[model samples]
Target: MKSKGFTLIELVVVIVILGILAATAVPKFINLQRDARIASLDGFVGALKAANSIVMSKATIVGIKSAKVETNIPNTDLYVLDGHMSIKPEHIKAAMNIEGFMVTNYALTMTRTTFVYLADKELTMPELRALNCFIHLTRSYTQQDGSNVIDTGDLKVNEFYDGC
Candidate 1:
């Protein structure tokens, strides 16, 4: 009588095919987390740029030389967009209008004049916390024709991709 089951050779061949497929698929899956982190960082950068532009426009309309607009968060000092004052971590959160998300999802650390990101332990890998990722905002004064002019510093992202 002929057997109605797969032969040992046939079973081994099927297993080999599955293994090859898995080997190719696993890399794509592993990269998903990195891609997601990169996207999140990019989104945050876009938000920062948008917020800065809005604040600057408002300041210009109000005839203020500096970013002296009220923030979304109460009891926080006004953000000086003209670079007269260094932006604080709270200022950044308020400017981005993502205080709730930041509070719930990530830890913000202030080092000198830079804001650093640390992923929450419950939601992210410990390696992310050790990565050097930060944003820096600085403002300086320059003398132009014997007059002091405030020069706004651009926002800089450092080691953002390294963490991802």
Candidate 2:
């Protein structure tokens, strides 16, 4: 006799194989979030570096790179931080000028140099730890204020993506 349908044992075996495949696939899918977060932060870092270069070039050309504004960055109130060789953490919005970006988490710590950001807003503090999944940007002290930016190795961008 020819079987018109799959036997119960065959169906069970197929289901078990599928279950194993699904189990493996689930982990890969879950890891996609981590990868996405990393990529996003990487992009952010690139954008930040590009903005720094632009500010640096403008500073070099126009002779304005301090924490104060000698002249606006063509059209914005961005006072280039030549001291840190980057814009102030507070001026990131003005520097990047991306639409709908709210870097509200940025604030000067007590030392007024280091700033840590969650990078991914969807992440919660309790999910891991605040410091674990943070992207840190540190600005070193410089002598110039309202002056042009020079390459002094003052900008430090570090990421601790342990919990991401």
The residue pairs that clash in candidate 2, if any, are 64-148, 65-147, 65-148, 65-149, 66-147, 82-149
Error of 1 at 163 (Å): 3.8
Pick the lDDT winner: 2
Model 2 lowest lDDT segment of ten: 106-115
Can you give the TM-score per candidate against the true fold?
0.62, 0.70
Candidate 2: residue 7 Cα off by (Å): 1.0
Task: At residue 109, give the lDDT of candidate 1.
Answer: 31
> Residue 118 CA error for candidate 1 (Å)?
6.0
Q: What is candidate 2's lDDT per residue for 19-96, written digit by digit as tens?
A: 999999999998998888777767777887888787677766766655442246555656565433444555776677
How would you encode candidate 1's per-residue C-alpha lDDT over 1-164 as one tens digit per residue? Answer: 98999999999999999999999999998799777766766666677677777665555555553443322322334465443223566666655655323322233432224434434432342444456343333333345687545344555555446655
TM-score, cand. 2 vs. native:
0.70
Report clash pairs, candidate 1: 67-81
